[model samples]
Target: MAMEEKTPVTLGHRSRTLTAEEIEKLSDDKETVSDFKQRKLEEEAKKHWDKFYMRNETRFFKDRHWTTREFEELLGQDFELPSKATGDQPTLLEVGCGVGNMIVPLIEEGSAFRFLACDFSPRAVALLKENPMFSKGSHRAFVCDMTTSQLLEEVPRESVDIVTMIFMLSAISPEKMPTVINNVFSVLRPGGMVLFRDYGLYDQAQLRFKRGHKLRENFYARQDGTRAFYFSEEVVKSLFESAGFQTKENSYVTRSTINRKEGIDVPRIFVQSKFVKPQARYLMQFADGV
Candidate 1:
C-alpha cells in the first residue's frame, strides 16, 4: 500500500480548535499568584527589556515584513500629510519599537513622514539610532515604559497621526494594558489611527510553554527573563474601545510553519486591528458642515 501525500497549509492561514486538554491547561482558574508578586513583576518590566536588548542587541527578532501589506493605512492613502510650510510632516509614534525592525522598512518604503519611536530598553533605542536608516529629520528614538510613562509628554497630545503597537503591548502586564491603550489614545490626533498586531491566545508558542513558567492567565516568562502575553481579539477590542477608540477592523490571523526535517508544525496566531480615536465631536460636527 502506498502512503497518500498530504497537502500542506501555509503558515498563519490555518486555524484549529483547542483540544480539551489544551483548554483545561490554559484555564485561568488554576493560576494562583499574589497581587503583590504580580505588581512587583510588572514594575520590573523595563529591567527585563533593557537586559534583553543589552544581550541580543539587534539580533533577537527579524525585521517584520508584513506591516505595510497588512496595513494599507501606513501607505499614506487615507490621509496625506499636509505639505509643510517648513517641510514638517505628519507624525507616527511606534511604541516598543525594537531595533527599528518595522519602522526602518516603513521609512525605506513609504513617503516621508515624521516618526517618534521608543522602547523601554535604552539599548534597543541605541541600536535603532545606529541603524543607517535612522534620521534626525524624520525619526527620533526615545526610551519609555508604556506601563507607567505618558505618551502625551513626549509627543504632543492629539498630534500623532498613527501609533504602531506591533507585538509591543503584550510585554505590558494586563494591569497596565489599559494604561498603554489610554496613552496611545492620548497621543493620537482626533482622527488618527492605531495599527496593532500581537500574539493571539492559544497560539502554538503559548501552548508550548513549559510547566511552571506561566506567570498569570495568558502571560508567561521565558527562559531569558523576558515576558509575553497572548491576547484574544475580544479582549484587545475592549481595551481600545474603553480608551475611546472606535474599532475599524479586529480579527485573528493564524499561520502555520511546517518543518519537514523535524516532522513538526508550528502555528502562529496574531490579532491585528485598526482603531481610531474618535474625531472630536466638534470636529465631527464641523466636518458634517463641510
Candidate 2:
C-alpha cells in the first residue's frame, strides 16, 4: 500500500491577551458567588460547551498539525511507532479528542497505527465521524465520559498501545482527574505509553480569573463559563505515579508569544510528560523474545 503525503496546516495567530473591558468583566462577573452558586455556574458552563460544539462542531479549534510536532518532541522520533510487537500496527486511544485536532494529523502522517477517539460530548463525536480525514474502516470515535464511565467496557482492557491527553485533563474537574487517569490506565496495554500536555500553574489564564471565578483553589471560569484548572508539575507527577505508571519524562516548557501591538512578551508554561505502563509478565516475555 502506498502511503499518503500530508501537508501541515498552520493555525493562524490569535492574541492571548484580553482587552481592558474583557478583563474588567472577568473581575466583576462573579464577585459575590457562594459555593452553591459556583456549582450552579459550572453546570451552566457545561451546557455552554455542549451548545458551542453543537453549533460550531469541530471548527471550534483551528485545524492544525499539533499532535505530530508536540508528541514527537516529548517522546522522541520513535514515539509514534509500536514497540515490542512485529507485523502489527499499534493501537491508540485519544481521550477528549475533540473534532480530530490531533487524530487527523496522525492519520495523514501515514503511520502504522489504528486509533479509537472518545469524547464526553456527543456533538464532538458526531463531528469526528463526519470528518473526511478519519477512515471509518480502521478508526473509531465514540462518546464516553472517562470520569464516571467504565473505560474498559467501551474500550477493551489492556489493548491500547498509546493514549493521548493533550489539553484534555485540565478541562475536567480537579477532583475527578485521578479517576480519569485510572480509567485511562485500565484500557492501556502493558508497557504502553501516555502522552500528556496541558496548561501549567500561573499561566495567563490563571492570572486573569476574576475574584469570584475561583471554583476551587486554582480552577477558574472563562467568559463562556467553561472552567479550567491550571496544573503544577508536582500535582501531575503525583497523579500519574499514584496510578501505577513511571514518569519517563516530565518538564515545564515555557514559550513566549509577543503582543505585536504593545511589543510586550507573554510567557506561557505548559507541562508535558510521558509515562510508561509496566509490562505484565506475559508482555515482558514477549519483549525478551521468549
Candidate 3:
C-alpha cells in the first residue's frame, strides 16, 4: 500500500467578514464570567457532559453520514487497508467521540481502518458500545479526557494513521488546548493526518451569547455548564503548527441552517482543516546535514 498523502481540495461555503455593527455587538459585552464561577464550570465539565448524554442518549445528534463527502480522505482510495504485504492496518482515533455518531456511519459504509474512540463522558462511551454495529466492528471505545490523559498508554507511540477532532476542541478551555494538541501529535505516525471541524469565530451560537456568558475572548460558558471557544483561522493554524503539524487546509466553512417551523434561518460558521504530522525524515534533517 502506498503511504502517499493527498492534498485536500478547497470547497465549501467560505465565511465572510463580520460587519462593523456585528463586531460592535460582539464586543459590546464587556463583562466576563467571574473567575470563581469559571473554575467551577471547568471542574464540573465532565459531569455536565455526562449528564447531557444521560439525558439525551443517542437521539440528540443525527449520525454524521456526510463525513466521507466532506472529507474525501476518508473515502475511495484512502479507505483501503494496507495490503497483506505491508502486514499492518491503519488506525483512526476520534477524540471526543460522542455516542459513536461519526464512527457508526463509517463502519456502516465498510471502512477498513481499525478505530480507537474516546469521550470523557462514560455515559457517552456506554451509549456507543450499545450500538450493535459498533459492538461488532473493529474498534475500541473507552473513556478518556484528552486534556490530561495519555494516548500512548492505549496505543504505541507514532502508530495512529489518522486523528479526527470533529467539533471536539471547541468544547475545551482555550488555555488547556495546547496540551491536547501536543498529545495528539505524539500518537500520530509520521505523515499521518488530523481532520478537524469546529465552531468558527462569530458563529450564531457565539452571537447568541449575552454579556454574562463570556468566559474570555471568544470563549463562553453555556447555560448547561458546557463551554465553547470559537476559533479564528490564525488560532487554528498556530495551535496545530506549534505542535509540529503541517497545515494543508484551514478555512472557515459557512452555511445557513433553517427551521421553517420556528421561522429561523441562521448562518452557521465552522472552521475545518487538515494537518499532517511531518515525516520522520524531515524531522531528523536540520539546516546542516548531520
Identify the leading candidate in terms of TM-score.
3
Q: List the residue pairs that clash in candidate 1.
A: 11-255, 11-256, 12-254, 12-255, 12-256, 13-254, 13-255
TM-score of the candidate numbered 2? 0.79
- Better-scoring candidate (TM-score), 1 or 2: 1
Candidate 1 residue-wise lDDT, 178-220, digit = tens: 9988888877777788999999987898888876667787888
Q: Indicate the worst ten consecutive residues by lDDT in candidate 1.
A: 7-16
**What TM-score does structure 3 among the candidates reach?**
0.88
Model 1: residues >4 Å from true position, as ranges?
1-15, 27-29, 33-39, 79-88, 281-290
TM-score order, best first, reads 3, 1, 2
CA error at residue 145 for candidate 1, angstroms: 1.4
**TM-score per model over all chains:** 0.84, 0.79, 0.88
* Per-residue lDDT of model 2, residues 152-231, tens digit only: 77887878889999888988878889999999888887788899989987666676665766777668777766778888
* Better-scoring candidate (lDDT), 1 or 2: 1
Runs of candidate 3 exceeding 4 Å displacement: 1-14, 76-85, 281-290
Query: What's model 3's overall lDDT?
Result: 0.86
